[model samples]
Target: MSDRSQLDESGSSAGEAPAVPEWLRRARWVWLGAMLLGLLASVVQLADRETLVAEIRERSPELSQQEVDAATNSGILFTLLVSALTLMVVLLLTNRMLQGVNWARLVLTAWAGFEVFAMFITAIGLAVLGRGTIEQLAGQSVSAVELLAQVLVTALEIAAIVLMFRPEVNEYFRRMRPRLRRR
Candidate 1:
């Protein structure tokens, strides 16, 4: 076919940008929701420091009150910094993904996979060590809000991943692929 004849209705030739599909837009919002939920969970977890101290004490009866207090303080600061950094990374990647960067989409998929894998490993370890059930974990180290947020985050991530790979989204990405190569 002639190059001009091959142009899409958008009046742009091949390798030119096309309008983003609706499914990709929905996927971006869904991914944003997951990131927000994760941020909320991290904040809630840090707020309940007494429970953190108690959990630490239960695991190590030998640690003095002073040591536990020190550890809790440091741990809270570390967790907060990590959470903020993670949030920044998520925002950057999501922006790139929406711009039709295929690598960004793959990175997000890998992230979700790693999160699910880590959760599975933690659950198995807890069960094998007879640590306690989800209810018990909530009562001890984790707050109800945090646990709920985590579950919702995981669900949303999975939903967003599915949406990202829809037929229309795939076509959009395919159209964008040539543009990427030229750059």
Candidate 2:
């Protein structure tokens, strides 16, 4: 029998699986682009610490300058750290997905879903609390460009999720599945 037809320990032919689709390859790039946009948004927010501090002071005039500074600085640092970590995760997961790891696709989809839900909850909370508008909540940005970046990133994430679920991509994942060994 030819090597392609020979069954391995998994009882499956070596060449049984289909190749990854072009759309899925494009989706991986979109995912990376979204992560880059998110990182940019975080940087912009970090640079707007003065505005954040001023807003805090306006909300509570009783707060000392030292307290406002500490709060703003720490908050910006935390956001920056989180954004950096998220970028790392996106890179790792994208690489895995490109390699046709089924779990990676599922995990990335779940992560994107959670992010969308969180953004919605945050927007509702901001509106209810009489804080800034939805645009402001979206990116913590005063500039239009920053706001657009935030919106674009969210859209890209949604698109990536859809692309991952396409029939061709699903077939690729199935083919990439590892063989299970009996005990």
Candidate 3:
């Protein structure tokens, strides 16, 4: 039989249906939740323009008023651009993950791994330098809501990674692989 004849209407061959497990479906929603939390955190940070400018000024005390203003404007613009790009990436990856794309899962897992590693490094640096040094450098404390949101986002990311690796999800990916190759 021809390869084209083997594929059903849904694009899977014969008996294979692109059936996503409940865990993967839940993982997709968790990813969406994480994305929303991230957006909230970004918005909260962006909303405090005065504080952001004050921190920038504090760090660069020697800068003239005009220079500081210019820097603040540029910084806000950069932040907004980055936030928009991040949102787009999160949406794209979440959609692909829902479609049983193994590469998307791996990419997201790698991103989470990098975030964990960066957190570890920051913690170690803070521990080595002590709280006083950290406070001096940071110039301000993170709000409780922001901290909670960050924690929730991190937990959701870890949960999604774990869910994507479940036996049924893994099997689904495996079954989809050959079909993808044929196309």
Query: Least lDDT summed over 10 consecutive residues: which range in candidate 3?
Result: 8-17
Report the poorest 10 consecutive residues by lDDT, candidate 1: 134-143
User: Which portions of model 2 miss their true places by more than 4 Å?
Assistant: 4-18, 59-62, 118-147, 179-183
In candidate 3, position 35 carries an lDDT of: 77
Relative to the unseen true structure, what is the C-alpha lDDT of residue 88 in candidate 2, on a scale of 0 to 100?
89
Off by over 4 Å in 3: 1-16, 123-129, 135-145
Query: How does residue 25 of candidate 1 score in lDDT?
Result: 85
lDDT winner between 1 and 2, please give it: 1
Q: What C-alpha lDDT, on a 0 to 100 scale, does residue 48 get in candidate 3?
A: 83
Q: Considering every candidate listed, which one attains the maximal lDDT? A: 1
Each model's TM-score? 0.78, 0.72, 0.79
Over 50-101, each residue of candidate 3 has an lDDT whose tens digit, in order, gives 8877887878899988888898788778877887788789779877877767
**Judged by TM-score relative to the true structure, which candidate is superior, 1 or 2?**
1
TM-score, candidate 1, is: 0.78
Ranking by lDDT: 1, 3, 2
> All candidates' lDDT scores?
0.81, 0.77, 0.77
- Per-residue alpha-carbon lDDT of model 1 for 70-103, expressed as tens digits? 9899988898888788878888888888888999
Better of 1 and 3 by lDDT: 1
Sort the candidates on TM-score, descending order.
3, 1, 2
Superposed by TM-score, candidate 1 places the C-alpha of residue 150 at a distance from the truth, in angstroms, of: 2.1
